[model samples]
Target chain A: MGMKCIGIDVGGTTVKVGLFETDGTLLDKWEVKSRKEEDGKYILPDVAASIREKLAGLGLDLKKDIVGAGLGVPGPVMPDGSVEVCVNLGWHHVNPQKELSGLLDGIPVKSGNDANVAALGEMWQGGGKGYSDIIMITLGTGVGGGVILDQKILSGRHGLGGEIGHIHVRDDEWEHCNCGGVGCLEQIASATGIAREARRKMAADSRDSMLRKFGDDVTAKDVLDAAKAGDELADEVFEVVARYLGLALGQAALIVDPEIFVIGGGVSRAGQFLVDRVFKYYDYFTPISKFKAKIGLATLGNDAGIYGAARLIL
Target chain B: MGMKCIGIDVGGTTVKVGLFETDGTLLDKWEVKSRKEEDGKYILPDVAASIREKLAGLGLDLKKDIVGAGLGVPGPVMPDGSVEVCVNLGWHHVNPQKELSGLLDGIPVKSGNDANVAALGEMWQGGGKGYSDIIMITLGTGVGGGVILDQKILSGRHGLGGEIGHIHVRDDEWEHCNCGGVGCLEQIASATGIAREARRKMAADSRDSMLRKFGDDVTAKDVLDAAKAGDELADEVFEVVARYLGLALGQAALIVDPEIFVIGGGVSRAGQFLVDRVFKYYDYFTPISKFKAKIGLATLGNDAGIYGAARLIL
Candidate 1:
């Protein structure tokens, strides 16, 4: 039997763990409850203990059979694997690598931001697979992205390099972002943003449509589904979301022209309908180039985070 | 004597060359006429001849004292040192590295986009000195920029990466950019753009001041100078330019998140007044972060291309 490594995705509620072969094949995976009290003290120790138990069940020893471990934390990860403040996890200036390595008796451990790890996973085995340089846009509750340049993650000086959600797309926006800025791409393009804009339109106009039936309880999925079902008002919201996303992506393209763009997250569930429309606007906004990048859907789903974490060491 | 290498900067009218030590010191520099005739056939040959002549005059031999050569072309460069179309030099699909290497008996040569090379030069010894990751914005006849991430130039798939100027900054702009886009950062922040805006405002409004004297010929410098000398109308124009440049740089900051930004090219001559004003708006636009990047002016001037070109091989 070949040696195996561990991959962990640490979220606010749960921690996902995976046992992966050196070549990135996931042999087994499971999730454990995340204990966030006491400044998240027990979280990492629990992760370590869980890994040890799993290895023992497989007749494996931590000394030789388990080579290393990689973690995806919901925070900004420094290049040296140190984490800097995850408000969601109540952590501050923590060295994930040192702590994990110490718990495993110097067995190497690597760490990265959850979004960045997901991107690496997509690039390695999912949508951006086979491409060395790629950009992954995860359109979940918020719009987040990660850039892989020259076959390596572009982690800049402050370790906030993949903060694509914060890129300002609207100058006329009066309201501030959750991060305290106006017209952020996230403000108009995120899942929450779509619902918010849909609600705004509903309040202003008494249009006869399906969204009006949902009133204030509409979700981004509901709007997208309504648009897919040929609802006029719902389609308008979708178009606005597509336009903002496409235009911002067009701008992002000029900055770091990758071979492909992998669209993921909850909003991406709309699939080809969303990609086709966004591609139209992306083409409209881009400079007439000899070649343009292809837009694709993320295939790995939630398992991408664990795969990418394992890749951090592999 | 320490072994040195050559750095060649190819432009439409002239080709500047320099001899640099491995430690990045400029040993000597000179220029030659750029012959764009005959589809740029004479360009590389002329460069090779010039190198031979310079080496002979210095009592040096290409096989010994000179290590290698680097070039900065006014075009996109493939990762492998192949060049795409260079309209300015009347070139189509030119492989500068192989051609120069063949001409000089395989002495080895490297190539890169002019803006990217200048960025590397600034990072090595200019305003971005002491920094490995940086973004260089050259506000000249048109705004052009290059990005350095993790100490390497972020050359995208088509070698058009770091084209920060082409990032769509305005949607209302009707006039087409040379790249066929509208409302690019180049259209507003360039030296030419500033003057063009001032001319448009002067023709439409009667609330004028010193700018009325220069009429259509007022330059970015003229506007900066007038603003410095207390001209209200010129100050208004300055505010617009600063607003656009500041806003664009702030957005770019969210992408690469470099350690520093080095402002160069013709319009950067506005000096601290320009940087200070841009910073005021950049700070206005950005969220308060624990770590923020600093902005500085490029010190290399025109020689940046050659110095940066030399750095490609180094």
Candidate 2:
């Protein structure tokens, strides 16, 4: 007697789709190539067609098999179900909820920001399982995060809440951030930022290192692997990047003080070593001893966004 | 029939007490000399006797007239109602809620940190009135603040959730903050910090100013008053202090993104001038153009703690 729900996580390159039981059991999962044609006009329709085909293939009917659906958009989502702006999806001046709801024949679609959706997913069944208050940071191409307090996401009035990546962690920064800000935490904590720091360090120090030959092709993974291999230069690069990340996190701890911090994104594949390094600086920067937020790696990985989206409506 | 409740704001020097109706109407208010002798052994007992005498004078029965009592202590309060430490009250490892509950003859008592309680009070009837999500900064002898999201205080796991003063905004600070941190927001935003900055300016620049004559007797009020008089030196000092304070606040906006920021305490008395100055820098620091958090002066002032404490039980 269980019903199914569709979860959609909209990304820059593709859309992740998951069919799940109301009890959070994943029945099936697939992907849809995100066609940015006509300013994302066909995206929602494509999603609806995918769900309808899936339902027909499984011999399930709407209203009987699926009650509702949720979406995690690659942009800031207002509490009123409107998308402020989505640079990646060409989503501008759009209300995804109302638009998608009409397309789905009033299936009661709910939407949230992708990062916030991922956080809700983590809280629901990922690394933040059994935890209500949490902050999850994704350190892939960029540093993005979501905050959950009192069992609900803090989306803020203008959809700017949980924008932890943009907090100014350095005062001496000379370069401009993508957000037009100076010295944003994202500049030093993102995977791209790690590689940039490593490149700068190698250029300045003239040290013997495994990354000496890679030059501009060096990735954040290379830095982590070299550090793991005990390359002194790579380890030093790791420590500097980790220090800034920890300071930003430690400052956040002083602000919201969540129960646990769930680290995710492609860069988090470095695993326990990254968590341990971030926590070491986090502990030193945080003043109080009794207050400690447990650090854990994301268990859901790519599925976190979709699960969080489904949970948004569920 | 309006039932009365006693709201207590426990500070280091004096305890501000208020008699309020259950619906939040204040009937009367008074202050008591805080006798911190012998590790504050007599403090609670003294408060209890004072309340009993007041009730007797009014011919009110405890069980019939008073429904609840709340205290806002000047320290972190655990969920179980214990204060970890209170430097001013000489309290260490004391259960203020339990001790006060017993002293008041089993009357229901609830407590919270003074700043957290103050935030609740502001949310209830002050600058944050009708707004549940808010951040209130009290720039008194030290910089203290409280954060409320989704209509509840985030006291945190270690009772350190709302310690906004401790966010490290500067990396080059030479002197240590009272909390042992370097270059904390409190070191530049508090009244003492402002005066300290003003003193440093006076010592460094040979600018002829009214503050230079006052020597170490200069206060934050003096600097603000001088700036109001169009003192060039005072304006420069105000600019620097306001810059740091604004940067710290801008960093916070990126993190919590609350609906409003209530500025209170001694320094806030500098009034609209200070608020405008902060907003000027806040706007420059926040990345998003659509994002905005309304700034307002705290209306409750010193009585905010008592009202907030009373709110705990109400």
Candidate 3:
């Protein structure tokens, strides 16, 4: 029998679970709507049940060949495998490792911050293959970062090593973050922040040809489309975004100095337009960096989350 | 015979050397004025002769029990053990390891960045004893930094990992650095930067300051003395200096996450006043860092350079 395990990726709205062989081939997979009704206590057992049902359909016995389980939660994990906080799940100080381990009949369960797991997943089976030092930045609703140093996830003393979103980009006039910080890199560079800045900028004056068409429904995608159509305002918006992001990347380089940076998320679809702006500004800020590192798009896409979670089992 | 080795710390104006046991116990140590007339080329032979004379006094033979030699130069060390770009010594690329090895009649020689060797020395015998993860910041004329992560010095791919002096503190307003960068933390927080900024601020307006009493000969020490005497400008200078340093340190903590920060150099003599201010601002920036690691003074002082160089032999 092949060595088998279960990998689960817990997101804000849905939970993705997959059964994997020791070599990282996905045997089977399943998904379920995350517990959106209650305070998340109602969904714990449901997640376990969904995994068991999926495994049973594949004629796999959890007690025998399924050696262990791995999970990627959407927040910081305590060293003891407990969830310290998750804004989406509204969880604080909840020990997900103990809960999952007990639910799986004492099978070993490992968990980490979601972004870190994704980077690991990318390294395991995606674009970051064979790279020992890598950084994965997910540009979703918010910016999330994972740092892999010396072939291991650098989950700082309290498992908060990969919180790239909170790094300060603007010195003074930064948007207020949910974490109570101001001018965080995420506040100006993340998709949510970009959209917010655009909306604020648009409301101040309705002069742009493209933004004027959207009226109140201005979205990040709209900005991308307008830029694709050569809208000056949309291009300027991205230029500012990329400048801030590039500066933050330069600052981060002073620390991680990783071999490569993998850019992911929904906004990254803008491709070279976004990357070019970022790289152009990155050079102006990286004066003392020693190594020549490259920035590349994440090749794994949404599968990265699932793939990274699965890699935890190995 | 027990294993023995010689360590030499070559500075612009002075040469400090020591013979030590493999375990870091100091058998003997000495210092001499360096001969800068030969463009620093003849300095290595002088160091080798001094070490041999010391060993001979102890009735020791270098060709027998002595294992090897190590050196710490005040600049970036190329991977092949050459010193590069020492502005003080006016050296571009000098092979100190090869030169010293030749002087020792074929004894193997090892070399590293001066600050890095100081940190290694601390880990081997000073305040950083027993800690594998440490960052040593020397607060002298210019701030110097050395990082030891997982028992290895984190020399970035180009041998500049611990250039803490160059970390960006102010946005982009930093004047040109001797290293050709702007806004480097060293340009604002270093003793040189602090004194320079202070003199400029004082000279802008003839205020009632002890700084005026020092005339144009003002130094960082004068500002510290005035602050000790309760001069508001001097006190404010310290606050400004500490805030910049604290912000830079908080940024460093986000990446390296060292267990302890060992601070050295002459400026560190400001003692608790500097440490207290840096700690106050450090906390403001690192609200998410779980480990509230302590910042302490470097215990080894000038000997650290020689001790750290000796450490490379082991």
- In order of listing, the candidates' clash counts read 1, 0, 2
lDDT of 2: 0.87
State the displacement of the C-alpha of residue A129, model 2, in Å, after optimal TM-score superposition. Answer: 1.4
Every candidate's lDDT: 0.86, 0.87, 0.78
Best by TM-score: 1
The numbered model that scores best in DockQ is 2
Candidate 1 C-alpha lDDT tens digits along A110-185 = 8888888888889888999899878788998888788777666766667666677877788767888877878888
Q: How well is each residue in B59-125 modelled by candidate 2, as lDDT tens digits?
A: 8888788888889998888878888789889999999988988998898999889999999899987
- Quote the B-chain TM-score, candidate 2: 0.96
Rank candidates by TM-score, best first: 1, 2, 3
State the weakest 10-residue window (summed lDDT) of model 1 chain A: A150-159
Error of 2 at B202 (Å): 2.5
Worst 10 residues of 2 chain B by lDDT: B282-291
- In terms of TM-score, how similar is model 1 to the real structure? 0.97
The reply for model 3, stretches above 4 Å from the true place, is A1-5, A36-48, A59-67, A80-82, A203-207, A289-291, B1-10, B31-53, B59-73, B77-111, B172-174, B289-291, B312-314
Better of 2 and 3 by DockQ: 2
Task: Please compute DockQ, using alpha carbons, for every candidate against the native two-chain complex.
Answer: 0.67, 0.70, 0.39
